[model samples]
Target chain A: MTASKDKEEISTYKTQPAEILAIRDLTDDTRYFKLRCKDITMNKDFQYRPGQFVIFSLPGVGEATFSLSSTPTRRDFIEFGIRKVGSFTEALFKLKKGDTIDIRGPYGDGFEMEDLRGRDLIIVSGGLGAVPLRSVLLYIEDRREEYNKVFFLNGARSPKDMLYKRDFIAMNQRQIIDTHLAVDEDDTGEWPYNVGFVTQLIPKLGELIDSENTTAIICGPPIMYKFVIQELLKLNIPKDQILMTLERRMKCGQGHCGHCAVGGRYTCLEGPVFTYYDVQHIKELI
Target chain B: MSKEKFPEFVELIKSKGKLFGPVKQKEKYSFEEIKDFSELDFDYQRTIISPKKFITPAKYSTLRFVKFGQTEVLPDDEPQIVMGVHPCDIHAIKILDRLFLGNIKDPYYAKRRENLIIIGHSCLPDDKCVCQSTGTDMVEDGFDLFLTELDDFYLLWVGSDKGLGIAIEAENLLEENVSEEEIQEYVRWQQERSSMFTTSIPSYKYLADIIHLNYDSDVWEQFGEKCLSCGTCSLVCPTCNCFHVDDKIMMNAEEGIRERMLDSCTLPYYSMVAGNHDFRPDRTARLKLYYTHKLKEYIGRWGQPSCVGCGRCIAYCPVDINVITVSNALFEEVCETQEVCDQ
Candidate 1:
């Protein structure tokens, strides 16, 4: 994998192979690809601010950008949790563990964790939006001492659809982090946790929301962003302090391709991670 | 320097190798080999596409990847000159130069660009063209040679040594002792013609500030309603330099070439990611991005406006979603001026 340090200086040309170390099926439609650098070990140490994405490629097929699901601290291997929604992701799902594919970038601006220091971090992720937020949560975990309190509230379509279940459960048991898992329905009764839309759990986490130094980082389907952000606002988090990641069809991770732009900002370049204050005025971004 | 004869200029270029110029094709014009000086079409507005098609072809082999124990790289291409380009298109080429040849320096575009000699054609304004507003009415320097047609004579300015060489070889067709008044008159005429060709926008400096302040303005919905999102505006635009790269291997799977092609922000799939996360998931966001980038962000960086007002985008858009019209609308709303409002 070739990781670009400066966001705008990236060229749309280069591509390098990343060997898939593991592929675990999270759900019928969602799978996790554990990738290890083949040509460049520098990418292993590739530090990306949370919410940034990497361009993953299948040679001869095509390339697609995916948010880094693993924290920057996990330098040896990067993980991508993808939902089979389109041709490229569907093709990626067909690849086996040993299969090698081209990878370019850890492109675009990721979530700004610097300002959240000494603050309560509220992570609200819906569906596969958890993929990018996963990186942020892991980053906070790596430096748990710096942060006040970290609360993770993740919502999926159903109990079966939740990702990183084992890790989430283990973390919850250790109480190293406060974790809330909400499902649209408790159909299989497999999950004995809080059940409902993720937004419902927001009101119940009183201390996490009431804290003055609270910062909410949200990523999810458009509908989820609307309701989740609405909840955060009700809790009176400053607009600038609320961070959200947007999903766009990014052909080139660089700013050159007009794709991935929300108004004047290229989501792949200027942001995938944006403060509510920055995007509040830009309509239809949700 | 001294002027050279026109016939000698043609002969000199012919001696060097093949020379290309705009040739009249039906009612339109296209870049083709020049057999004689009369075949040149100086009246053409803009080509079907910018000259970018030459450097970065719609489909060209980027590099060949062969597996001989390990992967081996091979490139495919030769160099050629592109001549008789319009001032607006020349400006577009310069934008591409900044993108493809500046920082990263794409070997493909850089090689072809180095091989090419740009001969800019002075714009004699047409109703469809607005190169003047874009500040490209007459190029100061992006070409090897620039030509302006006078009454029964062609005024040639040698911008590079290659152009001087051509002028020297074309000595027989040149006339000596041309008056300074004639050159001044030509420049004056070009300036006057340019002023008439432009479609005014608000002050370029205030563009970003205005857009940022008016982000919630209802103008976006108005423009979005009219925008077809066919991407013609960006495709024809001189400064919209976004592109996508893909790798295509032969059926044998042993070898392939990586290809980079122009991509437009207007396309829906341009921002679509693997996990179904669409950053700018709606048409309103996309339309707003195009205008702000051209009028706001680019202006913020370059000081000058990103768009050169080469009306090719206005001319080629299927739905007539001209940037001039949209910008003027925004300008009127922000400045409350009747002048831009009337446009």
Candidate 2:
């Protein structure tokens, strides 16, 4: 009972340092920051379920919630695929290694991996939505023997905006996960990947088309979600099996802020990842 | 347990400090000082708003920040008791309690809640009241003392030890050893008077199940047309605790205070982001969420509806778009029309 009480209290008061371990520029507007917990013991024990996000803060500058790109198994470090679109992210992009920041997290109901055991997994990501899905993919790879089949389809504005380049190549070479990448437009002589919308690849991925035990996880911009869900439904995936991650402007990672709520459900509490059937009727989610 | 000694109770509170009760202000009523026993208006259906304003005022500073090296913290304040709160308003206070005292407990609200004492009054409902529908007509907890008014005296139920102490201190005012027959008479009188009050909605449980069934129900569009988005309904609501934090700097740049003010979902900017994305961009969606959260989500999570049916929303609304009317319309739609609902 005391352990459960502590677990319940975990979501309330949280304080962790945000020491930057590594930084890599993904695009002109996006950067990947690898944050290592300053306290080694805290870092080793910091566990997060996939699809959960953390509130990243730069002192004096504001804080914003970002989906963790790192898998829970990798406790030594956590990563964030931040797009420099808002004031907070823009300021975050300027930070170098060894700079201190504030982090309070692993909040929200993450994807239920236990429920999907033995089922075929289909991951659909558009633009920078791959950040959260990356966590799920890594989790699956860590326990590869548990799942039946794995497939990944990612879409980006251009080849340059595509995240996790070396990681995608490594995953492809291992042949553990069937991976397909798509770009919106073809560069004159630079790129050689599939040049079309990400949803267009859904029909081509025969496993998702034929498998009845398939659970497709989708995360993207609002427009991307609508179009991708439409395509997945066309492919005859079960509504309850189709998981979609939602994005909202979150202040307090806790549900008290009321900033990230979609109708009755707080995106920060009930879900950032909700099955289509759960949110299908919630019109405001889209 | 017995008849309250009203005058002595008043004196006990007065000895502590000023005691606030319902005082008529011009045409509207507010929680103000009870100068004398005659000034107290127990018959008023509900105040223009809840007494939460005494704790978390409409606007107040929470934290003062100074760059003394690098640290930020809040300064505290004195506490007081609010007497004669209606049952519905007390229920609303309980809802705020859950929000503030839940997993992520808010220090600002907790500080005030811990120090304050609530003395609830049994409501005499008016035409617009639906406390029965929301199951908030009488409170079992969340108060130090609860009083049910009778002909010449008030039947007091002591809930907390503080209440017992207050009653004991006011020995001169109370008459002990009241007969069980008199207690039965008071209960019967309250029941008879309460039955006359109108219930805008039916059973709360049934209402919760079918409340959102009429999402596309034209009632929202109708309400939206009349709603000024002035947020009077949310502001006057006792359970509506949504707030926005802001920073204020004094004339001297050396010091600044961070404060949180009550915010309303009715405003277009309530859900607005930096990139100009407003989730509930439509007025209908905003209005629907307000009622759905109060009637459905709050009950679903806390096993009780957030609205106490104090009728402040009905009374304060510029166009009078009451929650009970909207909930009743949906209840009828779900039971009669057999329409599927949205979550």
Candidate 3:
């Protein structure tokens, strides 16, 4: 396997293999895997920022990009929260814990703490959307004093669908954090919290906005942005102040594929994350 | 630069590498491998397909995964001599050079480029050609040798050391005469070529700005209804370089080959995300994106429009959707008003 540090080797469609250290079912369709590089130094040197993505592949199956759910500060292993949506993910889901899989990337512009520092944060996410934000949340957890008040609003279909529940509980226990949960039309089982759209919780986050110092980081289903953005705008939040990550059909992860283009920008190159001010000009985005 | 002895140069280069030149297939001409020098026909109009496929193939095996999931890159190392390429097509290759060989070099494209030799010739403009207005009717570089017509003979312009080496080696076949009449003939051919353009743009400058102002223009929706979504325009373009990759696993599950193939934006599912969110869901949006990338976005970064104006997209389009016509419609309207104001 070539070193991930080589830009040419890493950027090519060619992939290096990684071993799955552990696998756990988060939901019926979604699975979480702990992957480590086959080479010990690669595992130690393999670093990625929050919101940066990797093009995970199932050799002879296909390739798809997913956000690095693990924080960059942790060097033991990298994690991905994947849902079996298509044939590629289907192949990945079938792999056992000991099985090895092909891997490439740590592509795209990621969320930076310097950009979000000195501001109170409100992270709005739903379902698997929380995966990338978990990186930022953990980074903030490491340096707690850089930010002011922090709020995390997560939504799921049911109690069974929630990911990293222990971390949510741990975050709620922290004196500096306020966590809220919501479920949309859950009928399969009991879900404790607000029982409507995730946008409904936006009004409940009072005094979290300081105008100049408050920044909102959002990631969710494409449709959730419709209502959530409206609520953020209702709070008189400048479009630039509201930051969100976008999901697109990313193939190259380096922008050459042109599969994930939104308007003039390649989501894999220019973003997977953008301020509302940046994406408002794109007519395709809601 | 005697026209009769040009076939000798072709024969000489054939010994160096695989020789390719334009050959008449039915009514159109295409770059095809040939052993005999007489097979080349420079009189035919345009090829149904651009020669872009020689570098970036339609489908290729990029890599193979072995037992431990390690990969081996499979690149085509064969050298080629591409002869009889048009100046417009030469411009298109330069555009591709900027994209693939720039900031992050695409290994697949770079390897092919290294093993290739380009010999270009000036072509007469057809009715659909907008190369004159697009400023791609002529090119200064990106070719080893460029031949321009001059009455009964041709003027050979060597662009690089490789071209000079070929010229030096083939000096016996080349005429070394200094005649004023022959030089005037070449200048006259240049002037004649300038008057052959049938389609002209009112303004090539500020074209990106024009597109920016008309982002919501209804003109795109009008063409959207007529577009069959066949994707022939992108397929025939010399500069369209978008591609997709897939890994094929055998039943053994331990090994598979990674394949790359050219992808078209006109396809319905080209931009579909995991949650079924497609940014360019409608035909209008897709066509707009196709035009925008060629005219606006490429210029913004690369300092020139990606479209060489070879008009292959216009020639091959099933629905008669011409990018030049659409751009002219946008520019002629605004430029008319501006000219009147200046008067």
Candidate 4:
């Protein structure tokens, strides 16, 4: 019943403190934080993938799972685009640079970047779903030659909720990637991009590129997936080729905690990123 | 030599480590640290809290951190023996073992789980027990010593070198060997006890199929309407392994201990994600998730169901919603519907 500590890697549930290096506000409720290792870097052994999430712990407040918004290509620091939702995030949102916060993981079996190589990538994101997808986008941007073509479709409710607005504009102007941005329920007049659902933009993918050769990835609200996936399926994208990231209250960030499980699959362990083919059997995936 | 010597055995085991097992607390039974051997009750209807609490604990600090400085993870562990654990609980421990010690090791759970000794108690079934149906009433290998209570004397199986050492230390209380006639009677007793379980699913193997086919089954909704979303069922379940971790500030306010407590899936916000995106927002979906995880999903992943036929969930649920009732309803209705489709 006893396992030797010498043989095993670092203990999986252990938490190490990380100091806040920088904080940049994206909206009234959301902020982008760049944190450097305070002591031991769990990141060294963690080998954190682009789409994986970490359990951010604020001493005296609580713990919450936040996605790694920063690309793994930048190994100097870990970054998160966190929105103040619950009390835990409210406390985290208040912290400034040089402040320390506890973190465990870089949990979840994240996106298989190797699988997307040489394939035409179509990335769709809604609201703050762009947080984790930012890691994916930036990662792919670094290895531009490895993939065929890239298309990014982003949707937000209004200018206030829009994330990475400046980056999207710059990436669109670069011409290497096709970027489409939209905002529904926008109160701000004279918006530059299309003002409708993101699903409306999928039709723009016209016969120029082959749907069979494309890998469509979606990260958005549960309500947004129905129409977006319907549009992707209409384009004849294979179920296996269409990947979607799922969100759940991941407490343990380990498989034992039933909080993050979709059906029997633990989202923290199996994925926060699961292919549509994998979720076909998994019930109540949102 | 007989039931009278049970107290002496308890004293012997208690000498080794902290003795924890089922003891009558008011009207119900629960596993607690035993100070007196006489308090140890071999017979009980069901323990309100499962033996899981002893192994994993409800709450514990995993780490400590201070302002702008070092963060230390506490890995200190203690050794203990949990005596008189029923076969069903032994089975639950096996599942927990696989989960904690498997591919991705949970150091928090592993620290306590290791250096733990379990003595199996081959118990007689009660009205609520469905371990016979689940095949968990009889465990092939989970304990060092398995004690089966006979009419007059206790039939003990020293299953390991550790068990044999304990038995040898107290050789004065035990008989050398049982007669062939007594052994046959023991086997008959096992058969008789197994026949007592009244609750059952149609078949454990078909449980996954039934759940898969009936994802939209009205039965879950029916139970969901009655469900208070209180999570009493999950709290009492031996195999329900959900938990929450948080950090608490010490009196100094400069330091804090990061702790973990058991959480529940039945909570309305269990699946709520960032930006207020809720996956299983309603009671019906949450309840569906809970049932499917036990019967279908866990079996798919772990090669075995999380349920051990202990029926602790059924017995402890305040609303009277039962897994056996729902499972039977789902299976019978789904099978009938399938038959109609075939016709």
Candidate 5:
């Protein structure tokens, strides 16, 4: 079978140890994690784009996919904003600071930052969608001179349910990017931003920038896609310029596992980030 | 090799390693370890399961772990010779090799594949066989040795160095030269076998386009209504290599072993996420994925359909949903008159 000298095989399934440097609660059910590779050499060499994800293996509990909430500009540590939703998350929540876990990848076709350079950018995130968008937001913030006008619109169910409240408020205070925060309802009445759906903020952008030079990146709940895309289209933003990150149940982050397959593509390989023009024909894609 | 010398050739193969061949049990044929040459049966049209079970397996432990440390459990490194594989199954194995042994090599599958040797046997088509349509009726390679049975002798084609080694070992039993009459006889046998195929998908070449055009057709729902969701099609198919992994904990809660087993896309919750979100919630969508992935999507990725037309899905599906019926329905776009769409 060994007919010719074969290229070195890339071990897709192998994982390295990543120790938890810190763990902080983002909300009642969600937590923000900061981790670094246990090996010093691996820690320095680890590189990933904003929209990529990692597979967190808990050994006996099995493995699950999580997005990298931290940007690559911050090379010291990797982060994930995980919600306690299922059995895997339930076990993950029990782990304390300084604990170690098995992680692999940086998989998926993340956002092409270089492609979006010099283009007017609008980043819209809602609920837990902020997790992945946070990475992109921080990436843009570090290299603010590369892009044109940048806008960050974030939404949550209420004040208490919002993730990264402190960090976003600080960014809003800095006035570097046009940061807009919206709450579905201001139950506490202490909210300082708009008290309606985040889709309402989309119209405010109509008068600020030229739609032809603009690119909109959105990540939100399944229901938010229809309204957000409709508003973006009304503003004359091109369909191909409208990018979104998606979620799917994945075991192997590589293309081997069929769990993330949609139509003819795999979410773990071809996507997690797709243009509206690319998936508009797919009926199953939201 | 003549018919009388076949037993002696079999003995030579047995001396190499553990040999497995098709055997009849309970009126069904399966590949089982051969204890004696008399137990070998080569007349079967198809086995219950394809030869994929020998490589990927239905279930196997991938990693054994304690509380803090883990180690990969590689398959044992013993030479294995599988005899009597057909052309369609050989094509299916090639498809698997492309997926598992391609850019990202699966260590477990690679090890098992390297250790196993293939010995192919020619087959005549039955009513359910559609290999002729799928273009997998004849395998040019992917086997150590290929045997085409003539009237009085077995014309052995050495496909690899391993096969050449075996041919060298049993040189006395093999005919050194092909006679003029024997060459004509082999050509005639090939022509006769080619004409025996009774089932075919006429528009198989354009199946990818046809399936894409009819993605929203009602034919899938009709098939879905009758499907039991028992995952029998995937278990029997040679190219269906999707797997689900589970971690088994010890009774003491100290250690566990992660096991991977064959999974089917048509089964419930095949695309479900952690937060109870199911991408393919209903049977119709899941069933559509199964056919589209094999017949349409595979072509886009691999330049050919993954279905080699072994007829296992035709023989095994309780609801009569097979590649032939599904492809024809999509191609014609007329499922209203079929038995499935009548309801």
Candidate 6:
């Protein structure tokens, strides 16, 4: 019987205490939060890949999902780019720098960094989608030599709404990887990047991208997928090579909660990141 | 065991733990606390809710939060015996066990499950019972004790060590040996029960494929239009385990408890993420998720559909829409009324 196995069993629902280390505003609505496990052992041992997420439980409020906005290469502390959208995030936005919250899991199948080691990469993001893709870009930056030519295309509503604007500007200044930033309408006349959708930037990669060798990673609003995917397909990128991270209502980061189910697959289990080929047949997937 | 000795055996089992069995309440049947053996109405086809409620209550506290941190709140370790469970309901419990006890075990569910002792009883099929098609009509195991009632006595089959201990303790009231004639009679009873099934989901094996083929079918819109979204189907379903969690603060405001409650996909916000993006915004989409998850997706993952064909949806759905009507509509392209398609 499983009764004897109970002693060694760690409940999936069990959460660890995490204290806010730092907080900074990326935009009026979105903020960058850095948190570390209060328990030294847990903080030291915790490791997660890019594109995975954690469930932030705010006792007396509710629990919400947040993608890991930091890279695994960086040890101890984890970060999230949270937008004040709902009551949970509203409460989350109120907490100060030293406040503690319950956090569990480094769940979901994140980006496969090792697999894309030798491949050319095209990282794309728009709006809050940059939160998870930021982890991927930073990971590649840390291990720049392992991968081939890398191109980043980011878009936001405007200059003021852009998440991690300073970081992208700094990366662009570094000039090690090709970085292209765009905004729908730049309210700040001083904004240096292109003034259109991110999809428009894909054409500039015309001769630079080796279609067969390149793995395109995209994360953005639902509307961005159609036009962006069209551009990527025009470049002849294989369906399986085009990976996009998705968002769904998730309570438990584990597959126990059925909210994140897309067709037969649980987005929290099989993916929050899925290959275009994987979900092409699933009608409900957006 | 003889019919007269059954009451004495029940008394012995009641001493073991809190014994619960099927009891009649007004016009409906439910699994309630059995104060006496007479309260057990095993003649009924099904209960309003399966034994799942005992395992995962509609609502329970998972974590209790204080000033600094939170503590896990597990169900009390009181041993409970739920008797008179039908085979299909037992199968449903087994499915719940596999989900809640398999990889990434739910601690709360695990605790409640460990404290439960299942005692199944044989039941005859009614017009609504479709377990024959779902293949959950008979259960060989997953129960501590199973009683198959005969003409004048009961053939008690012990399935576990706990049941064996009970048999040993009640040996004074139990018949140790049975005749070859009685064995033949039991076989005859099994055949008669098998022939009694009048309901089945035809071409059950192809339901998954058909559901996929009809993903864009208008039949969903028709059903969704009638759906009340009351979530009664999921509540009555033995296998529906989706839940929503909330945090409730006490009046003092210093302490609170995180509560887990049963949630249905048909509900308004089952698939709504923060920022209010509802993946399944309309009734049609949500209704599709409910049926597809149970009928098609479960088969892909577990090699069997989650619907045990206990027929709770058929009996309880206020609207005339159910697995039978929906499946028939998809399979035969027929509706309950001719005007349904014409309109």
User: lDDT of all predictions, in order shown?
Assistant: 0.72, 0.76, 0.80, 0.80, 0.89, 0.89
Scored against the native two-chain complex, candidate 3 gets a DockQ of 0.54
Per-residue error for A63 in candidate 1, Å, reads 0.8
Fraction of the true interface contacts (Cα pairs closer than 8 Å across chains) found in each model: 0.54, 0.25, 0.63, 0.78, 0.67, 0.80
DockQ order, best first, reads: 6, 5, 4, 3, 1, 2
Model 4, residue B156: displacement in angstroms?
A: 1.9
DockQ of the candidate models in sequence: 0.35, 0.32, 0.54, 0.56, 0.62, 0.63
Candidate 6 chain A: 10-residue stretch with minimal lDDT:
A1-10
Poorest lDDT segment (10 consecutive residues) of candidate 1 chain B: B68-77
True contacts kept of 1: 0.54
The digit string of per-residue lDDT tens for model 2 on B1-343 reads 3334566577677665457888887877888876676687766777776888866667766545554322344324554677888888887887887877887666656777777778888767788787877777778998988887777667777889888888788666776777787779887987796687765565466766776666778878888877788888878888887776665656776667656678888877777665666778878878888888877777668887787777788777877787766776666667577744432
| Reference-based lDDT, residue B224, model 3 | 84
Model 5, residue B210: displacement in angstroms? Answer: 1.8
| Position B87, candidate 4: lDDT | 88
The TM-score values for the models, in the order shown, are 0.85, 0.89, 0.93, 0.92, 0.96, 0.96
TM-score for candidate 2? 0.89
Cα lDDT tens digits for candidate 1, A105-212: 777777667778888888999888888888888888888888887899999878788887776777678777798888898889877898889898887667545546
- Candidate 6 structure quality by residue, lDDT tens digits, B175-200: 88998988999999999999999999
- Per-residue accuracy of model 5 over A1-286 as CA lDDT, tens digit each: 0001232233446778999999999999999999999988878878788898888888899999999999889997999999999999999999999899888777788999989999999999999999999999999999999999999999999999999999999999998889999999999989998899999999999999789999999998888998999999999999999999999878776677688888789898788999999988888887
For model 4, what is the C-alpha lDDT against the true structure? 0.80
Off by over 4 Å in 2: A1-7, A11-14, A58-61, A208-210, B1-5, B14-19, B32-43, B54-64, B68-79, B202-205, B247-257, B328-343
Interface RMSD of 5: 1.9
Alpha-carbon runs more than 4 Å astray in model 3: A1-10, A186-190, B66-70, B175-181, B249-256, B329-343
| TM-score of chain A considered alone, across all candidate predictions | 0.94, 0.93, 0.92, 0.93, 0.96, 0.96
Tens digits of per-residue lDDT for model 3, B1-343: 7788887878888877888889998778888998798798877557776778778888887778765645557566877888888888888888888877775678888898887888888889878888888888888999999988666788888898888888889899777775899888777888888898888665566688877767777778988888888888878988888898877777786777888888888767887876666777888888888888888888767789888888887888888887777787666555654553132
TM-score computed on alpha carbons, candidate 5: 0.96
